[model samples]
Target: MKRSIALLALLLWLSTVALVHAQTLPSVKPEQVGLSSERLGRLVSMLRNDSEKGQIPGAILLVARQGKIALFESVGVLDPKSKAPMTKDAIFRIYSMSKPITSVAIMTLVEDGKIALGDPVAKYIPQVAEMQVGVEKPGADGKPTLELVAPRRPMSLQDLLRHTSGLTYGIFGNTLVKKQYLDAKLFVGDPTNAEFVDRLVKLPLASQPGTMWDYSHSTDVLGRIVEIVTNKSLYEFEKERILDPLGMKDTAFDVTDKAKQARIAEPFPNDVTIGTDTTFFDPRVPQRWQSGGGGMVGTVMDYARFCQMLLNGGTLDGKRILGPKTVAYMTADHLDGSVAPGPLYLPGVGFGFGLGFAVRREAGVANVQGSTGEFNWGGAGGTFFWVDPKEDLFVVYAMQSPKQRVYYRPVLKNMIYSAVVKPNGK
Candidate 1:
């Protein structure tokens, strides 16, 4: 009788935990949210046709408008090899989508007066003060050589948030500085966040601070700073402050639970290369570094809550993660004409970098269809999300196809906007 009572207690506890993590958003028909059911069917057919053709293994998409989920869909298999049917709860490696989460954590510190945007990054991580900029100049043999020069100014916390800290991801470019990053083998052993930053400061910056907007490891540096400020692991601080309150129970740097392991999504075996000779990390393997830039795995529902929180001005289910004005400040464009975009500008045209998102500056300038205030970012692993304040809409597309991400992002954006027949419910 005692053993039965203990088992019953455990089951009750698990049920209560599930209730805590349950989605708070209401579900409605697409039409109720000003979305055309017929048009949405077309979107479903496209994904299903692609899955049937083996173009994609599978995917889960959640479209929410006016604080209600209009379309929550799953198509294709979770694992192409195992042929496990794709489910709404399937976990995906969110990659650089992790940046927005890390960025939000830093902003929470900002809200608490723990850190200032204009403060020099070296204030928190002193090693950054010693880093130099790498400039390519002609050598005696007339061949271009890297020249390390002092930065015109120190990199501020804002610079890191905006990707203007002059840091470059080694896998994307072929510059001398990037070659040095490759030579360093930064991820070979999965160093702790501190060790990662230590090796990074030893390398030269790609440009002078705040001069260029480059997709980079700037968020990773911000992650280390977060660790330093809170005296907690990046995951720990984020969990306590953001994830737990938002009930993002499934989003984490890694997945270790045996039961949840079965839900991990996988891409096609041949579709893994992200950049020049680089592949996505396996989230199953435990690592010390919680790469704030590109090392998180989560489900579509978990991310929807996060997006909803941002859309609702940093509050969800009565829990305020950030102030409304802070959300406005974060979503507004930070870039102007002066800051030149780097060659690998991930924000594309008609958009600018905000704190953690690519804020759209115009509705018609870019080939894609989105509102002027829409802010978004995608992951190297193929997950994508955007929150359009103008449309009262947010969408989360979760997939694992690295090579096909760029193509599908625009396609999905165009199709989603096309289906908005009522235009913010008229």
Candidate 2:
């Protein structure tokens, strides 16, 4: 009788632990969340078909509505080379998606009165004050020449958050300033955040701060600021304040643990190039540069919690990450008519950049289907997510095909909005 009682108690304890482990976002039927089950099935089938055709190595997509998961599906293998089946908890290199998290980190400092958005970036990193803009001018021989000019105004923290800080990604363009960035070889030796910023500040700005929307190393600089202000590494501060409290156990700068390394998703060997010449980094290898712009890996469910927090007005499961008003402020459009959309106009038509997201400004101007208030951003490694406040919905799509990201992002967006059979809480 004593042995049986002990066995029962052990089993009960195990079951209780399992329940606690499973207590992420609750799962519910598609109908319960006002999504069409058939439509969601079609979306999954399309992804599966794409995988089977070898168009992609694998993918994991999560769609949640009304604060409940309506669909969570994994298709294809975790790695094309290993042929390991993809699992729901498979990790992905979320690249630029790291920006939003870093942006949130900066906002947390703002909330605590440690930083202000209007504060000049030079206030944190003094070298930034010496930075100058590069303008192309016609030389005596009629060839284009580079001229360095002082910025009209200093770059503010808000400028970094909205990507209007006159920074440019070298890989994206071949202008004089961009060429300087490439010549610097910023990522050559796996420089630490401080070293990276020190090298970056020496480069000429692509445009005057607050005058252009150019996607660049602004977030990476923000990561250095986090380190400076908090007296902790970017990952350390983020993990403690944001990831730990939000139950984002699998999100980090890299997959350092031997156990979780197998779960890291990979792209098809042939489809690895991001731009014309650049390739995606290996997430399995740990690095000191915790790139705030593009260096974080996470599972779909882990990101789902992050998105849920955004959709829930910056709180999840009673843990308030940021106040509702702050979330709204972050999501609202920061660009005005004066800010020029540079050569790489990433936000596209009908969208304006918010703090760290491309917020839809209208219902019809954008080529893709989405609500006006929806804010979103994506990774270079084919991971994308969006939060539609109007529909009370959010979707996270994870994959590893960098070359196919542009094509698939819109296709996935159109398909997801199509799955919403009922809208506006109907």
Q: For model 2, what is the error of residue 214's alpha carbon versus the real structure, in angstroms, after optimal superposition?
A: 0.2
lDDT (CA) for every model shown?
A: 0.92, 0.92
TM-score of 1: 0.95
Instruction: Give the Cα error of residue 127 in candidate 2, in Å.
Output: 0.5
Candidate 2 segments exceeding 4 Å error: 1-23
Per-model TM-score on C-alpha atoms = 0.95, 0.96
Residue pairs in collision within model 1? none
lDDT tens readout by residue for model 2, 1-426 = 999999999999998885565447989999998888998898899999999999888999999999899999999999999999999999899999999999999999999899999999999999999999999999999989999999999999999999999988898888999999988899989999999999999999999999999999999999999999999999999998889888898999988899999998988888887764678788788999899999999999999999999998989877889999999999999999999988898989999999999999999989999999899999999999999999999999999998788999899889888888876577
Off by over 4 Å in 1: 1-24
Encode model 1's per-residue lDDT on 53-159: one tens digit a residue.
Answer: 99999999889999999999999999999999999999999999999999999999999999999999999988889999999999999989998899999999999
Give the lDDT of residue 406 in candidate 1: 90
